[model samples]
Target: MSGTFVGMPAFPEAARGAVHNATLRANLRHATTTIRRKRAVAVAELSDWAELREAGKQIKDHTLRHLDRYLEQLEDAVTAAGGTVHWAADADEANRIVTGLVKATGETEVVKVKSMATQEIGLNEALEAAGIRAYETDLAELIVQLGDDRPSHILVPAIHRNRGEIRDIFRAEMTRWGRPAPDDLTDTPAELAEAARLHLREKFLRTKVGISGANFMVAETGTLVVVESEGNGRMCLTLPETLISVVGIEKTVPTWRDLEVFLQTLPRSSTAERMNPYTSMWTGTTDGDGPRAFHLVLLDNGRTDTLADAVGRQALRCIRCSACLNVCPVYERAGGHAYGSVYPGPIGAILSPQLRGTDSDIDASLPYASTLCGACYEVCPVAIDIPEVLVHLRERVAQGGQVTRAGTKVVLKPARGHAAERAAMRATRWALTHPGAVRAGQRLAARTRRFHPSRLPGPGKAWTATRDLPAVPPESFGDWWKRTNGGTRDERGGSR
Candidate 1:
């Protein structure tokens, strides 16, 4: 729900442009294909992957079921460990709390680890508006920041950009932020990484405040974990004098023992590695070790509303592995930008609508963005039934049902442009209930089959534009059955 994505075009309209970009398609295809193959191999090496996935799902379900208790326990543990806890009920509150925390430190600039929660709240924009400059230290995040672009992927935010484009961004925009790129920076991976490293190092050493979002928070110990392939997370978590983390309340697990399940599944599912190269875990603050001041902002931002739905609550179990993105046929082609949220791909389709309510054009269109392939569910570490949620959300959008917005229950008007669909569904239900009417309708359709237009007019044109209307046969199936048999068959034996 960041302002960055506000007023975005609906998915179909946005995807129409993305689908035409050959270079973007090439970049996404190569990245997703490579990751997909490697993930398969990495997952196959584990003998009890199904067990691990189920265990992960059960743990999240149990923790979410008792979320209030775990959150209180986590807050107490954090306070006891010398860290302060702040509860944020929505995006505006979270941003205000983080901005206020940074202002309290008297620092004008803060270094950031890659954080989806921060992105969700649009923290950088909020900080910038308050005269605080926030620098993104993650390699991919750096690319996005330098280009003044929004992230298109979750794990690898700059997945849409190739090497050459990255080099261009650094060369053109790096100096305005901090360190400038090398004059002769090449398009090689090593060179690009080195350019980002040198550029971020100065900011890392000088910045007095650091901000992050955690992969998981241990309620029993008040420890937060961030897993990454690069060591930038370590630097951000340790180097700054003041550290503030904005985490969704749903990211908390009951104990360190429950954290074990995700530590195994996340690395393999995300980067296709047995273990990530860097995993940083910190509890409160340590003397003469890391940041002397620690603040944790717990963000609720519609998560409580999402948890209120039994069928939709499973989305809270996601570990941000992004396995579902790689396997999603829709994501592969439409790309992440089309989803119009910090979260993209299959997860975004279901998650965004719930978090933001399907009242907006972009949020309303997201549930219809997928093809319902179920590939996302097959690869999900916590087995979130994404297709099931998509359909459920579709019903919510079509029928206009009771939903929670900002913690209050409200009924939404059915989304615009669905009147015909709603009427058709009602007609279908009626015909199915009345066999005689269905028989009559079928015979009428068969008789007037040739008179049917090849293309429809008005509202129906949109549906028929890309699809062919199936031609009706000369006779209905029921009529053919009766003619062949000459009479109804007796239930106990043969035709009479």
Candidate 2:
């Protein structure tokens, strides 16, 4: 959806380079493995984890079903509390609203909390285009910004980078952004964190405007919540005179009671902790307490279109915990950049295509990025059936793109690969429907089994490249059944 990631190739082509980068694979493997292991242990500590997970799912589903009523209720609550609310229908609108608001403040710079919504809408780039500088305050986000790179992971954006690389980024680029790294900065975790802390401190204190996205927005009181391990979000939320939050409309919960479910499940699923180190929540504004002015921009950005599909709508239930990414086999190897969106891994595989439409090469290929191992589903805190959604999206892609824009079906010509697959399925359907043809085909395959190649020829080669073709049997099951059962048939004309 953001032009920042424009011109990305399809998953197959994009992933090819990532797979060859040994260092990137190592970094992803180590980080994800550590996180997933700790998450498993943390989850095991809870006796009612399954119940909590289900409760969170139910809350999101119920809220989504009655989204319009709750959004209006939230807007009224926010307005009543002295905060202004703005509705953004798409990325451009959201960016424009935020940029205009920032420009109105008469400030040349703003500080940002780690926000996927902002990244999705390309808010930083928009601000830069308007000659406003936006500083990233989160530890990981700081590294990404200083290195002049795009975020790969959702929770930990720079998961593709190791300690040494981060140390290098800090030493080389921190001077240009704000403070410079120590002359002898080491790659140890503590040292890197301290370096980032020092680098972001000046931005936090001086920046008049703060921008953020929320983990959950309470509709009952119009409160927005941001939970994080580091204290940067707290600094950004509290210190700035003017604050603006760009949140997905789907992040809203009907009441504080519904918010309880996510408060428990999200931290454990994401950071593998019983609770985050800091959770910053605010409602409207108060004199001498936090920001003087609060602006809540509710972003739709194709979420309404995504909600139209019953099978695909479950993706809206995600809290962006990123638990699925940690456990995904495809994500472990190919890394997040291959997905080509601010959102990545298993969730991105389904979410990006729906949000952006399958018109682009990157969005079109995301559904095929997963191996359907179901690890992501098992680890999901809100019980999103990622595999089911992947299959549904694959069907949409195969049938010439089923996403709609402005009440019209937006169809792209099927990929050349899919066309071949459609032909194969058609041939398969015809043969399966005709018993005579099936019998003849099976006999033919048995006779030719010895001459069969281990690797396929033409388009089929891609499938067989990393996998073995199963050996054709010496005889068909029908012939064997007939021979073993004395050519007997039951009343139903089945083998006895």
Best by the lDDT measure: 1
Residue 282 CA displacement from its true place in model 2, Å: 0.8
Q: Against the hidden true structure, what lDDT does model 2 obtain?
A: 0.91
Q: Model 1, 420-492: lDDT tens per residue?
A: 9988889899989999999998999999988999998888899899999889999888887777564476534
Candidate 2, position 371, lDDT: 87
Q: Give the TM-score of candidate 1.
A: 0.96
- What value does the lDDT take at residue 25 in candidate 1? 97
- What value of lDDT does candidate 1 attain over all alpha carbons? 0.92
lDDT of 1 at 182: 97
